[model samples]
Target: MKRNALYAGFFAILSLPVFSADRKPNVLLIVADDLGYGELGIQGYNKDIPTPNIDSIASNGTRFTSGYVSGPYCSPTRAALLTGKYQQRFGHEFNPGPPVAGNEPIGLSLAETTIGDRFRKAGYATGWFGKSHLGNTPEYHPLSRGFDEFYGFLGGAHSYVNAGAESNNPVLRGREIVKDPGYLTEAFAREASAFIERKKDEPWFVYLPFNAVHAPLEVTEKYEKRFSSITDTKRRHFAGLLSSLDDAVGSVLGKIRELKLEEDTLVIFIADNGGPTAQTTSSNGPLRGFKSQTYEGGVRVPFAIQWKGKLPAAKVDDRPVIQIDLLPTALAAAGVEAEADWKLDGVNLLPYIRGEKTEAPHDALYWRFGQQLAIRKGDWKLVKGPEANAARGGTAGKASTAGAQLYNLADDIGEVNDLASKNPEKFKELAAQWDAWNAQLVDPKWLPNRRAGARNRNSAENSAAPASKWKSGDSFEDDQAPQIASRAFTISARVDAAAPSGVILSQGGPQQGYSLHVKDGKLALSVRVAKQLSTVVSTEVLPAGSHQVEAGIAPDGGVTLKVDGKTTGEGKLASLIQKQPGEGLHVGNDGDAAVGEYTAPANFSGSVAEASVTLQ
Candidate 1:
């Protein structure tokens, strides 16, 4: 009888909600898109971009110095955060490419249970607002994936100001399109505050994944005016975006306080991934590498959690924690015990936050992004990725380099010192642990154009960089390329040819596509639609020192070719290709299935560049 009483009492204590005795607490999870490690005022380095509302989460509760996301990108981190497991466990390793008609594999696997699903099952009203990159297909929509209320773009990104009909990814309100969504961040704030206000009597979960601070940076004058002092154009723009995000956060926070739900709401804030410093001027201060790489700057991000009157305020926890923990922790706070069969990779952090547990929330955190892989155990990390891209010798950009380097992050936060040769034992141990984790994960549901693991909104442009920037023998997946149908576009190139007889640029295949090449010692343009071919060769022939080639496609099905500012050839087709070219864009060679009347690997012999011409 004594033993039975003790067991029952322990279970009761563990299962009790961590809020007032009336009802379960509401959960407000705010995720920022492509934010950097050192971009916030609270992060100590960035004084320019003040984020008081975001910083308040830390001032009110706890701040994690070594906070991280599971993957270095958007969708993969989101997958892990929602499922409470490593995204790779179920093969959600990369961002699913642009939504195509029959491409059904491009989404989060239906097998995995989501946090929204769990909350709904537990009788909580659940809502998701902002970017849903999981998949854009009907079956993969948030409504189908357990979210009761979804008001965001299905693709990785959407224009913040343009809620127009022509966009590839449109703003959605439930199943209907939102044609007139005023400024996205503020719109999200209003919707979220309204949801919380109406659902005050019931348990609720609100996911506000703001797509700010990414690319195509644009904001209203109200936010931009606040940063008029900063002069650098890009930096000034970035400041405005950051300010806008902070204000949006403040609006939501204010609502909770106004409703007297401060103590009964669990507020968590984290960035989807680190900054893409090259694309946007976002900084990952005191950290090396950018968004696409496996360095600290790519994976580490600002993280804070607050539940007033529950977790201690004004605390800083240096122990490493990850986005995956949010799911299990939220579940725990709701007084729901995680099932044994869930196989969750995240730990319930309530105990640790309350000082009931002293150790780290995670003994080890692992990541596998395509060719890149990392495992951080304690202060030591074993990583193999493109950190070599930072000008180190023999250390190539390939992650599967037979062996990964070791680093004690306690001393070398920048990862400059490769201690693998010195501490062979530690390196081997971590390598082995990463291998074990890798073996458990399945193959990805879908693959990107390249294994670059791009996490941005303009991945086709960003991931295709360095490889397709006027380089020979490089191909790029050009999704919804502007050349198709009635959409008019121009393809221009500058080349220095050794011998003027090769393919310059080509996309698609024999069935439907376009190509520009030097044919019969003269510039030629070809357009193939439904196997009906239209080839036009230049009237003038012969040599070249430096030449400019341009191919223009008119919406009225007129094609024109120009060489060195001279009209070479002109042709009228029945119609241009209607849909997206199935094949990818080839820089200097026709990859495999050629669109032109040339053999395979019609490689350009000379250099193609924006500026390779020199006048002696």
Candidate 2:
């Protein structure tokens, strides 16, 4: 368990002989958030949402037909992917704490060595491109964990357009905030390509994880315009997002090819888990269940590997492969041997890929998150969920064992037909296996982030920033930016209070809009929309004095509202609730009450200033 002393000087010592140039290959692992099995062109998806670049990897190499991540959710799968072992061994069995409050302490244990740390020990220059939700604290940062360069946010998700979304804390470059203007996916790709260009002379391992198809459904006008033929709003946005992600993938592939690194680069593409079809119209096709479940659709995802001229081309493998395999596979490819004493759970897939080994790589794959549990041993899968026994949408009832269901994926991929009763013996065997796996897991290291805090304001303002500046006839349109935050107060402007001279809020995207309304002593704040009804809420009663009010992402991906640091109102958002797109900032209203124009509420407003928004 001792740290490799040579790791500190390896990045600078390019001449070190870790591998002969011909024996070592640079690794570029790309992972998408919440992407489904059938969402890509290689998987027989839409022709309009062409994924020529993503397909390029499959076309030239292997496309895993039954590829799977270790867990259905984001953080757990990432833990397995990075560690080459079951996350339950070290207790990272659920998503980390809320990214905003920095509350999630659950992280990959310091005792466990990461794949990047492995590469660093072998003299590889390591870098991480996007989405580091594995940990948020300084101790768990990529730089501290062997990655020489780190870009992208440290949270599970962020706004695609607004730099303020997630309060901007999650988006960073080597511990510094990077407000790179343009689409987040594209920015990640740009930085990745640049990173490769800069390190062409040395052996490198770049974990390029892209957060393209996740929530906030925000895409650039250019991408959206590409889908002018699609009328359904959700589908159109989803198509745009997929198209952009494809382009980003293509861009990275092209960079490798252009740099002549394709032959030397081992490229892998996978989704963190399955899609939340409700949020992004990502099609899971025939797979049953969405994300946050134990069904096949929740865990099985689109997986492909591209190592030019080395791996077989245009091939399909039906074996179930988990994300955990990547750790050992990459290490094996780099000619660095994994220690036997480490007790790694995954075996190198090179032997199987090379047609040297015929057996399946893993005997059983297991998952545990919150109250959910599942185990896939060969074709048999044992699962228990709140909705387990439902024939369609009906609940399986509250009885834990009565609610449990079993499916033979070899026979039914959709999981429509449960075989628990018909094949009681097989179900019992797999259920026993699942129990043994669950018994090994420690309790969830941290509960989901559900703290009460001011939403729509900079973290700096959360403590001490500028005072609120509200004015009549002022526009708060900019308050709707995905990243910009507006703080609400319970106390009225006091009528006698002086009005601020200028607008305190700075709105960005054109569609970003907001409003402050007062009716019968109740102050209502709302997100103004162009054609649709605005989302409004009544602030808690003002206590005859100044009081703060705010709402933003809850720890569990829900929306929470707070008045003076106390919970006031909360609502769950459909996955599509993203900030409006725009450029101009409106303080109170746009001065015009026409459609799409901000209308100033007649209520006398107070002074507002130092209003800001940020992404965490």
Candidate 3:
């Protein structure tokens, strides 16, 4: 391999001892988006995609077989990872929808400190390269959130190919959009490596979160050719994406080795959340459920760490661990003690990994994502949520949980067995503990990005007819809201779309109900049932005159949206809303929880003549 002039000045730092207290360790936090637990070769579940570089981090140091992320979705997990606290503690319980049911900023709460802040305060060169799902607004950019430099998109997921200013989510170099950011994953790898090389003289913390193997599964021609063996189109694309990620990891690791800084770096690898199998052909192995659910497959992910000479080699630590622990561990590696008032959910794992502690880092790990939640105390676990609620929503209603399932993770890692009946006491015990934990949490800072994450605090589940008709914008309480639990329903409205855009009528706030609105002058119906969103938008812009629009749902969950008796758009939901939406109807003007993309108090600029709902 040929070495360039930029690599010529790295000879002095080569001989630093692995366990030396003479210098602080640099941190490399690499996060993969929606990666399946079974995809990594070290997990021994997938034989298709080989992730040698990532697996080496496990082979060389510690791999937590029971590793879990705080949330089953992208933003929540990242928020916890950076802040070192449960996101729910600060009301960041769901992905930033429009405005939440309550008033809160659209990104991570500024009141809380982040890992980047901690490391930057410690005099380290901090940089974030890759997905910055924290917030898209200026206040939430990586630069504002503590990183000195940021090179990536600010949204949850971005286009891997057309990642320019023209894309909905464009690549950014600091605050400016990069006109041409070739192949985002590769760009991230390059940006991370470049940061290291540029800041080789000082301690640096790099948060590299690659949005690979996510949707819009496009792979470079080179990587596609590399994965030509796979017959399945989706699987082959997945393999290629996974391979690119692996190679990118290898390249960055190689950079460190080339600079002889491997011994001085504390490296951590984790999937942001489990893969969405249906969308990307990702495999969670035998674990039940996929992304956005509270299962081992959704929250439990492939986690590994490496510090070269300081940690054990090829060790599998089965103790339960979560992503929240990364901050304290990285800080400890840097010789900084975590302050007590920080109140972080994650613990310093280096002590436990170094054999200084015999017990697990945490005694109990808890999670709350609207309609679904879970708690794990040792081998016993209690969890419940709809399966694969892809559109992560947050409820404005009471936290209702009536069907909590219990499982012994040691015996049933797949979560196929229901031990709740056989272990009533155990279930009740975990439930009480969870209730206590849930009580300490606050309402969401904002709603879910999709109309989802509506968690009911009470243990009540009832089936009833929802408010079938409404003409006013009065907010119905969750309990009093229309109860459309797994039933077919229809929403119809006659409104003027003369104005630009606004919500004309909405039954459920988000993630679990339907919203009829105008966006960018186009009429659209957003139907969310069972936490999955199926949006149908009209092809043409709305005319000035009053238009009659109706959203019809079939008994089998099929949905169609019509404008003035013309079928403008159509979609199909997997199922009806499994539970009544907490944020009730806000017909005419979404005064409560936002129903669509518009902000709360989403008053229609155009007049709404009549609005109603029909349940079948």
Q: Which stretches of candidate 2 lie over 4 Å from their true place?
A: 1-23, 98-104, 168-170, 386-402, 450-547, 550-616
User: Which of the numbered candidates is closest to the native, going by highest lDDT?
Assistant: 3
Query: Can you tell me which runs of candidate 3 are displaced by over 4 Å?
Result: 1-21, 101-103, 165-168, 387-396, 450-616
The global Cα lDDT (0 to 1) of model 3 is: 0.78
Per-residue lDDT tens digits for candidate 2, residues 171-236, read 798998876646899989998999988888788899988887876567789988999999987778
Which one wins on TM-score?
3
Please list the C-alpha lDDT of all candidates, in the order they appear: 0.77, 0.66, 0.78
Candidate 3 lDDT over 179-249, as tens digits, reads 88788899999999999988886899999999886765778899889988898877898899899999999
TM-scores for candidates 1 onward, in order: 0.72, 0.72, 0.74
What tens-digit string does per-residue lDDT give for candidate 1 at 1-616?
9999999999987764344466888899999998999998888989888899999999999999999998888898898998999898887776664222344467888998999999999999999988888876798888887788988888665556667522346788998989898999889888888888778778999999998876546678887788999887668878888899999999999999987789999999999999977546789999887775678999999999999999999999989999999999998998888998999989888898899999988779998775677899999998876534222211112235246778889999988899999998898888888887777887666554332333332444432223233444334544322235445566778877756766788877777788888889988888788877888788888367778888787777677878888888887778867655656677666654568776433656575665211111
User: Model 2 — TM-score against the truth?
Assistant: 0.72
Clash pairs, candidate 1, are: none
TM-score of 1: 0.72
Rank list by TM-score: 3, 1, 2
lDDT of 3 at 113: 92
Give the CA lDDT, 0 to 100, for residue 383 in model 1.
Answer: 83
